[model samples]
Target: MSKPKENIFDFKLFKRLFEYIKPYKLVFYSLIVLVILLAAFSAATPYLTKYAIDNSIITREEKDFLFYIVMMLGILVVSTVFQLLFIYYATWLGQNLVVDVRIKLFNHLLRFKMKYYDNSSVGVLITRAVTDMERIADIFGQGLFMIVRDLLTMAVVFGVMIYLNLKLSLIVFAMLPLLLYATRLFQKYMKKAFEEVRTEVSNLNSFVQERLTGMKILQLFTRENIEYDNFKAINERHKKGWLKTVWYNSIFFPIAELSASITIGLVAWYGGLNVVLNEGGVSQGDLVAFIMFIPMLFRPLRQIADKFNTLQMGMVAATRVFKVIDTTSQIDDHGTYIAENFEGAISFDKVYFNYVEDETVLKGISFDVEAGETIAIVGATGAGKSTIINLLSRFYEIKSGMITVDGIDIKDVTLASLRTQIAVVLQDVFLFADTIMNNITLNHPEITEAQVYQAAKDIGIHDFIMSLPNGYQYNVKERGVMLSSGQRQLISFLRAYVTNPSILVLDEATSSVDSYSEQLIQNATDKITKGRTSIVIAHRLATIQKADQIIVMDAGEIVEKGTHDELLKKENGYYKNLYEVQFLKEHVA
Candidate 1:
């Protein structure tokens, strides 16, 4: 419920946001022109009314009356045309601006380091990209430009009122201070209320998104009642935030209406008295014009406070969005090196790493894998087994030491080049809701359907895919929910195989599949890892017996390293104990 420290009216943020208008400057300048014309036409309408009354209506001149009526109708037509143009162009500009900003935000997020995602919430990010961007668009469509037009119209109306009758204009001006003070108070409280509303909106979106995503777990745990109550509390707070703004609006608008009514009453009484007594130079037309001008002048004042709030809300939203855009949590890709023909000789030399400071996950770990060698890494959970994959992929910068690929420092290679040379199949296979063929190639332009089939066939999954309802064209839906766990793993294997990367990493790839899927994975594994530089991390000991070398890790350090048979030969060795325990578990099952 605490407020953000940023000033909602900060001109620096306004200036920064205006930079997005550079591409559409032509449209923007045109919109400004239209707004000016509309304001002039609106002010002209009342003056023309006064002129028609004084010059023809009271003079019994039919010709002059008809001409003045036609003139007024013509002005109305022109004003209507300008209003339409202004509205259409303002909306077009808003949509285009938000599109540009959203694309920029998405591209920036794509480059952020894995650590950023680890600490960030997906819901908060979605709100920024979608909801906040919409608010920023309002800065152009409703906030800034609309306010400018209203103020301009007000100024033009006041000028005409003063020109016609100073005494009537003075009567209207007398009520300004009280109305201005009320608007000021409304703005002060409304700004805080708007900020709270925006914050609550973000929280509500995040809560809903997270709960829907985890609904399965919530149902499994039977915590529906508790979570629903929590949701109700958040919903109540969100409601209150909006109602606070509404309360301010309710009080301010009635006060504005009353002030306008009083100004009109005073203008009528004073101008009519002057006209009837024939003591002051107040004509019938001037009195009528003054009546019309009171509302014209006061209209903007009544609505300007609400417009300012709209502008303030936009600024608040922009602040949240720009904060994310300005984040410096991305990997530096300054390296010009491109390993076009990388040989996949990976080496981890005295590496030290920690996701959090002083909580090292890998402590001075060192290892080397020559080209075309397959290694199996085994450890108890939290023994830094998976951390190695993260470090090797350069998802996080090491606290110290170095990781090299084919004798070249990975930091000296472009991320695109480094990642292109490696393909990883994690235990949790994430398949986009797309056709199997697209998932396999990930829509890579160079990968053809025939090539995908060949890769799938090579990995022994082509037949399985063809047997599906639509074969390779079948959609897997989100996260491959449409397919069995084993089937999804096979699709994952085919995905990595089609890439033909120089290095293949299977991290817990077979940990959750059934015996039949495991057998198929074993066949695909043997075929794919043949003569390729590969690293396998698994809990199943029997599957790794043919590995070129086995590394046993304990805590953050490697405790043993050898071939499966050689490690088992050592009495009381780490690998031997792990193998025995897993072997017994499989037998019992």
Candidate 2:
């Protein structure tokens, strides 16, 4: 069981939540007035009933009774109108505020350094952005202003009770200390229960999302029973957390009702006895009104306790959200430089990088590629082959090094300008659930259907694409699940090609595919790489044989750098050994 956040009374987080309401300050102030109006009208009804009882019924004055009845009816109509307005605007304000908050959170998320995501759960982040935001909306909708309305109603009721009869009012309020004590205890336990529930909700979401995503692997390995048992345990914990809150409610509400019943009984007994005895202290009208006022007083207390829990829950959700917003894990994009004519000359000078401390992935590496040159990086797994591409794209900053493009330090240029000039096609191609044309263009208005068609034609995949049902309008489905691995890679090639990037990176783009798909990708690659600065990372040495230069890596350093033929001629060279092993495996297969 994860321990919940200890401090829910974070003023800073609460202040940030309030900042979203600034735009609707007018609505908020109007709500406060409406709340007061609601309370005033509600509190007036019992008094009007008492006046009719005393001035008309008890005194046998029928003429005045009709006027009081009409007045009471009018108050009820007005109260209902105010209640409707309060709910509509409160909910409206809450919904609009959440839209702003969620958007702000999403924008912050988009700018975060990729390392933040590397260490965070996708499900947890989704909870923060989606479900948790709904809870925060409750802060405005049902928590703050609603509580104020209830409290004001209770306050007015209290004043009316005393104004009618002091002794009976005192008797009614005598039970308050017990109810307040119970409410205090309920709040303490409920806060802990709610925290546990929230934590379990996030855990369950993450568990379900991950399981669904990996369902194929789970079934392949015959782990269905094991995973089911795990889910059952998690779900059981979730149920237990909610049940704790239920148990606390079961105890607290009954105590509150019992206290209210006792207070009402006291008011009835004391006020009725005085009236029957003709003591001249309590009147018939006053006794009638006390009955109505007692519930009015006690109901708000009960609801306040409940709404306080809502307010606390929202505070907890806000704390989590603001924590993410407050995080400084973002790449510095303060550089004002933007290249007007990017030439794609690349350089890495003594780069050193580590995903984890004391465990370097790239060690003092250096390399250079001229404009329009095609360079291939080859090595075994964990030879820092992919790290080089990541650094080049500024996905992860190098620990101590300088990477430059066209003689300008890449760090000194805006990320948009720097990345706009480069396009990467990863081995694992990800396509959105959309039409093939939209996936190819990625919604870039500049890349039209004609451009996509021509790019596909040049890559020799035009026929393959046109063969599909609906052709360019065909929906690929989520993550391109409807397409084969090779077909998805081909789409990615077209996507990269249409961008007309100054530098093109194909990171092991042909590593996993059939021979036929590889041939298609090779053709596409040849066309795209023509006269473009290209960096090809490949496990298959055959793909890079015609490269202008080949850099062989071992561990973290560049062990060999030369043209394919020059490196192959060196005795016992890293490139020569890699080539012979792969060549033998190909022929043997």
Candidate 3:
């Protein structure tokens, strides 16, 4: 079994949580006052009952008995009204506060760099955003109210008890220390149990999310039975955690009830002795009122125990959420330079990079491409072709040296403005569940319908789209699952073209399509690259045969550079070998 985790009290995290609630300070204050009023009215009821019993019944003063009964009834009605209003506003404030916090958290998460997501799990983040916010809201809505009401009720009841009869009051107060000690012990165990439950829940949620996302892979591998066993094991672990919590809570409640019963018995026994010893030492009214107040005191104690459980859960959730918000991104964007236009002149000056410190993915690389020129990078799978493109886009900053665009260091340019001037289309195409027209115009929302159709026509997908039942208005399914891979690629191409970017990056853009669709994409690529700087990363030698310059890479270093024919002339070079291999494969096929 895994050892229990330690509770790390983060005062800063708690302060941040309170900041979210600061906007509703007035509402919180009103809620406190309403609770106080309700508690005061509840505490006064027993005193009124005592007055009626001692003066009206015992002394036979029946003159104002009806008025006293009416007054008590009126207090009950007023208390109920105030209590309802208090709960309504308190709950409303909590829900709204949660909404504000969730929105802020989501927006902040969006601004985080890709490295953050690489280290965190989707299930954990989702749980924090949805489940944790709800738990915090429950604390504010119900838990806080319970705490305030219970404390107020206890204070008033104890004060009234002391004023009514000092000796009996002291006897009642003496039991309080025992109650507090028991509660302290219970809380220690309860916090541990609740933390275990929370961890189990997070694990279960991760299991479900992983399985759902990879359901296809599981079915393809015929691992249904194996996966089912794994799920069962996880569920059983969660069940055990919950059972432990239940067992602890079960013990807690019984001990609390027993202690309360003993205190009540002591009060009745000692008060009875005092009454018998002196005829008017304590009246029947006083005895009845003391009995009523005993339950009120114990009731709040029970509520305090319950609220402690809720507070424990909220604390666990708060800790998880703050973990994400506290993470610092490696690549910080603080540039204020915004360029009106990019000429697309890119230069790499002795750039070095590595995803891990000990393993270098790219060596000291130096290259320069003029504006409006086309460059093709051909290399093996791990030859750092994609890394070059990622660096040019500033997705990953170089460890040493620098990259410049339009004669300015890339770091000096605003990320938004820099990326806006460049368009990228990867091998795997992703589309939203929206109309074809929307997908095409995604890069430039203000593009006209005629421009969208012309771009689609230029890309050779217009005829196929026109044949569809809904044409541009058709609703695509999630991730464009309804469309073929080639069709999705064509849509993505149209999206890139509509942006009219000054620089274009195509990373194996035509690798997934058939020969026919490849021809259309090649034609579209030619038109898109006509007046823009283009970087094409491809394994197909034929795709970049007409490029102005072609660079061949090996082991993170460029080994060859020239036009297609010039590289083919160097028979012993890496480019020549790759071209011959691809030629043989095509001929055999």
* Residue-wise C-alpha lDDT for candidate 2, range 66-119, written one tens digit per residue: 999899889888888889999999988888999998999999999888889999
lDDT of each candidate versus the true structure: 0.88, 0.89, 0.82
Q: Per-residue error at 583 for model 1, in Å?
A: 3.2
Q: Which pairs of residues have clashing backbones in candidate 2?
A: none
Off by over 4 Å in 2: 1-10, 587-589
Q: After superposition, how far is residue 384 of candidate 2 from its true place, in Å?
A: 0.8
User: Per-prediction count of colliding residue pairs?
Assistant: 0, 0, 0
* Per-candidate RMSD, Å: 2.1, 2.3, 2.9
lDDT of prediction 3: 0.82
Mark the 10 consecutive residues where model 1 has the least summed lDDT.
Answer: 3-12
Task: For candidate 1, write residues 1-589 as lDDT tens digits.
Answer: 9976645368898789889999999999999999889888877767877878888888878898888788889998998888888988897898898899899999999999999999988888998999888888888788888888999998888888889988888999999999999988887788889889989999999999999988989999999999999999999999999999999999999999999999999988999999899987788889998888888878888878878888878888888999999999999888889978678798999999999988999989999998989999999999999999998888999999999999999999999988988999999999999999888899899889999988877777778888999999999998788998889988888889888889999999998899888888898888888888999998775558878988889999999998988998999988888878885577567
Candidate 3: give the clashing pairs. Answer: none
The total number of steric clashes, by the backbone 3 Å criterion, in model 1 comes to 0
Cα deviation of 406 in candidate 3 (Å)? 1.5
Count of backbone collisions within predicted model 3: 0
lDDT of 2: 0.89
Against the correct fold, how does model 3 do in TM-score? Answer: 0.93
